[model samples]
Target: MTNPFTRRPGGTPGAHLPLALCAAAMAVLALAAATGLAVDGRTVLGEPVWLKPFKFALSFALYAGTLSWMIGQARRWRRTLWWLGTVAAAGFVLPEISAITFQAGRGVRSHFNFETGLDSTVFAVMGGAAYLGWLMTFAMGVFLLSQKRTLERPMAWAVPLGIAVSLAGMSVGYLMTAPTPEQAQALDAGLKLATIGAHSVGAPDAGAGMPLTGWKTGAGDLRVGHFVGLHALQALPLVAVGLRLLARRVTVLRDLTVRTALVVVVAIGYGGLTWLLVWQAQRSQPLTSPDATTLTAAATLLGAVALAAAGVLLAASRRVPARTPVAATR
Candidate 1:
């Protein structure tokens, strides 16, 4: 009997196992949150302790599901790639979730905490696992790019573009780990800060936040870009599929050229938005606070997208053959 998850052409059932496990983990976290079973500690933002686990669980579910589906779509090395990818993902993700959940249960901080030797070791291990996971993800991206012939035109473009954008977003996390100017000044004053990493700029992490997202409402929060950037892996493919479906309905846009061009436009727009978010965070401005520069940038981005889309449409129209007149068909 063949493995259900190893279906040669489009085997995605195997990926579903991990995704379901992640979903179940999230459900447990949610139940813990609702029942107030574990409310001993709070995050830097003063949210419930279980919030971090819940967030990670949800993110892992999406990540696993997306990559598994992509790998399933491939015709080569289906089983080998699936197992390798799953291992890499599990290696990093499990350690992270475990560390966070364990620390939360102990009512202690998990990140940027080096008070105890054990805590330091855990943090170091998690960091190492994270780097390994990134390397594996990069390898997977390269593999997908090389398998262009086996993928749909839209997916062929989406996979690489999505990975690139997501990596850019992940890089923003480094900024949090680095010492901010304020922190450096404090260090100069002989003050010792608890943790070197922080998510907010120009304001304390304890500042006001949105209801569910916990994004800083009073200052720049780098996590916004980080969140949007990583989700592009899912967003771009969904956009590509939507475009393909639309092309089927519109005869004039049925060509692969038109579909690819539209997908490119969407990718560019998505990347631009991700950059805009990073820029906004760097400026220490709240997402809701748009100055003149922000307005100008937004307008410029919109204009560029419109022009690109129009150009693609015009080029596609030129390529379409003119209908020959039928001679007097009574």
Candidate 2:
């Protein structure tokens, strides 16, 4: 057999080379984008022109790095399937980043920009690329379901659940693509449409947004939920690792069932939080300005998760073996 991959010690798979290289490339792109932000001084949509590129580069770099790490943990994976996923993810993602950066250099929006024929083409291509990226991510999530059980119960629960929520988060972007009432009315009036979608609801785009993220501070912004969802890929896994580590000193965490139950509860709560954010955004409410009803719902979610976790810990304590007596005090 060809040993092209330099294997890691202790039965783990080596890192996926292509994806690792892609992560490095994205990191370099992010650095360049950051420099552009520092010097460009140009504004697009009430923010710096380079901001989107910088943010996107950083996100893609993190995503690629995470995929690489997960790939490292995979067992008995076929080289062909691995290469296929790597090629597809890198191919779609790199071009998308390039187009975003290229558009930023032109001082215009990469998404929803149809002001010109070329801009429309760019948006169309980027849209297609976005769908493909989501598909590849979904495939990876589904792939994890069939992997060997070498990981601990907590981590084992985290991987699939995390990906499931991430996929839902990616889907949230679809809400941004549907034509808003403004576009609908414009179409009804036979007016020319320069743009077809928007990120803000109940507020005009490029208005009164938060710094850096540009999420609307006074109105609904779907990007908030979208951001939360994508980060779940990292967030839940970190949670699992943290619990696993705490098992060393924490009595409740020492039980596999307890750790797994905690991960599940956390995952459910995290997913519910994403839903709440999206629901809030849809109601044209800012995340920082939730109404009493939203607050009540939020409290309920917290209470429910906490109650379930308490129940799990209580049950686990009963099953945990007690410490042995110290030789009856001699």
Candidate 3:
């Protein structure tokens, strides 16, 4: 029996090395954060400029590490997948992180900055890299789905679900890039400014936030959904693993039907939450400030999810075989 985490002999090195290197970079950034290195400007959240690099470094580490683990499980197209994943990291992730870090070091905004030729170029490059990364993720999801039988049942389902949800979540950022009415008016008023691409809605990016996350407390922030959706890759698979362990302990619930139903339920719930966050952000409502509309929408989502879960469980129960009761020895 082989441990999934350990690299097999003669296996092609995938994103593991790049992920490790990124981890090292994250360590350096963490040190910088701790040392309070001289960062020229604060983020829109008024946090130390080092915070951006520190956060991105951690995110990249998780992204690379999770993908590397999944790629290692690939029984077919191992080398090709490795190459593709590496290209994604090198061509997309690395460039984006580097550009952000570079801008942070210079005490300037990396995103939505069309003020100068250089800033516009960097922003364009980052945007291109982001699109490429999303495409690569889509490809990875397709490959995982094609090889579903080779993976653990929970993981097999999780891979595609996670990627799909993450992409959906990421799409919300596009709305933020559109020029607000005020921004358009400003542009028409002889201002050289092109558009504001920041994440906050109905308010400026600079404001009171929730500690390190920097999510706006006063207004809607699309990054909440974006962050939650991106992490589904990790969160879903982890929940699947836990469910598998629980199934082992509970004999009556050991059927694959039950386990699969649980996974489906969790995925649906997770997706609903992602949508709720995005919807809330669009309405310019803070996470903490839920009004009547929010409550009604939330209730509807929960009711729908509950109905779906019941249907799945009932359908599964009918298909699954009844367990034989064992007679106790006298």
Specify the highest-lDDT model's number: 2
lDDT of 1: 0.73
Q: Which ranges of candidate 2 are over 4 A from the true structure?
A: 1-5, 323-330
Best candidate, TM-score: 2
- TM-score of every candidate: 0.86, 0.94, 0.86
Off by over 4 Å in 1: 1-5, 8-44, 186-192, 321-330
Relative to the true structure, candidate 1 has a C-alpha RMSD (angstroms) of 5.2
How would you encode candidate 2's per-residue C-alpha lDDT over 1-330 as one tens digit per residue? 774454778766777777788889989998999999899999987889998998888888878877777766777554643764586566677878988998998999998888999999988878888888888877777676556366666777888888889888889988998888989899789888888888888887877888778889989999999999988888899998998777777766777767788999999999999999999999999887999999999999999999999999888788777642211110
Model 2, residue 207: C-alpha shift (Å):
0.9
Worst 10 residues of 1 by lDDT: 321-330
lDDT of 3 at 271: 91
lDDT of 3 by residue, 114-135 (tens): 8788889888888889888888
Q: What's the lDDT for residue 54 in model 3?
A: 71
